[model samples]
Target: MSDAGPKGRTGRRDEAAFAITPPQIVGPFYPIRERPDLATNLARPMGSAAEAQGQLIYVRGRVLTPSGKPVPHALIEIWQANAAGKYRHPSDMNPAPVDPNFKGFARLTADASGCYSFRTIKPGRYPTAEGEIRPPHIHLTVEGRFDRLVTQLYFAGEAENLADRWLNAAPHPDRLIVNLQEPPSHLEKHAMVADFDIILASG
Candidate 1:
């Protein structure tokens, strides 16, 4: 397969087809603390009255094969830092305070249509111990019956994206970046939405 994605003058791929979502490093933080909370809503825990702190957003997308077939029932796991750019893990020593109310992690399964949606807060950018500033992004692991993909999803217009080596180094970087859009009518009016489709090589 070509490392360079097929695109027209607009630099956008045709929606009718999909390229495999490029894989990325699992990173230093992979949620080793305990079992993940399997809720689709990360903004608020099951029993918490308070929502997480940050700009609330909804992420909805589909899991598909490279040939554009839906990969139903695929498992998707996501994790990110809180609004203050601090992770809840003990390994994160960024000096930023962790939000007690932020769940910051979630697990989801694609429906029969290969669609999945989750509610969460926008993460903040954090500085690495190596002096590099990491952009605000969500780490995801998508597992199908026959394939597993680990990657990161980035937001559009993030200045740090231009300098983030992990993002720029992807075989198909643009595929990993998504623009924030108006949330669907069913969701809260104040919330934004980002659509990120995952294309696995096999399922």
Candidate 2:
């Protein structure tokens, strides 16, 4: 029973050997419940007549461990404002109209490849209490086997991203941004796509 299993020549632990995705603030608006069926498709909720009004997009990514191994069965939850910049929560007192067809929340499980996808409308910018307009983003929480992480995903190339209080405060802002690109040929022509990968600290 030796304390030192694998150490550097100096017999000290190497902290730099491990680098995990940093956690971000969960904010104040997590949904109380998860409607799996309705959340899967924000554009068309279950038994909803009106179509969600906004650019239809696919948000997808993988959940991995610090060792780059896929984390299957991880729970990923996401919530965002509607295209009108109105959240479906009481705390959002903004006058903007909410999209009846949009649930603004989703809960998905990662597949064997650690991949998850959600079809939803692109969120709009909203003004904060400080009179500053917050950029369009999605609140995300990932529950893995060994760890749980909370973070926000921002749209790449958004000018407003630079002014986002939370994003600006993040030590690694680039990691929080997702690249918006054209969807695969199999998808509809109007659907856009963004990928955001999450890496947990623990293996």
Candidate that scores best on TM-score: 1
Per-residue lDDT over 138-196 for candidate 2, one digit per residue giving the tens place of the 0 to 100 score? 89889888888988888988899988878989888888888889989999899999988
lDDT of 1 at 29: 77
For each candidate, the alpha-carbon lDDT, in order, equals 0.89, 0.82
lDDT of 1: 0.89
How well is each residue in 1-203 modelled by candidate 1, as lDDT tens digits? 54345565543454447789999898887888867888899889787779889999999999998767899999999999999998888789999888878868878899988999998999999999899999999999999989999999999999999999999999879999999998779889999999999999886
Q: Count clashing residue pairs per candidate.
A: 0, 0
Per-model root-mean-square deviation over C-alphas:
5.6, 4.5
Evaluate model 2: give its TM-score.
0.86
Q: Estimate each model's TM-score.
A: 0.90, 0.86
Worst 10 residues of 2 by lDDT: 10-19
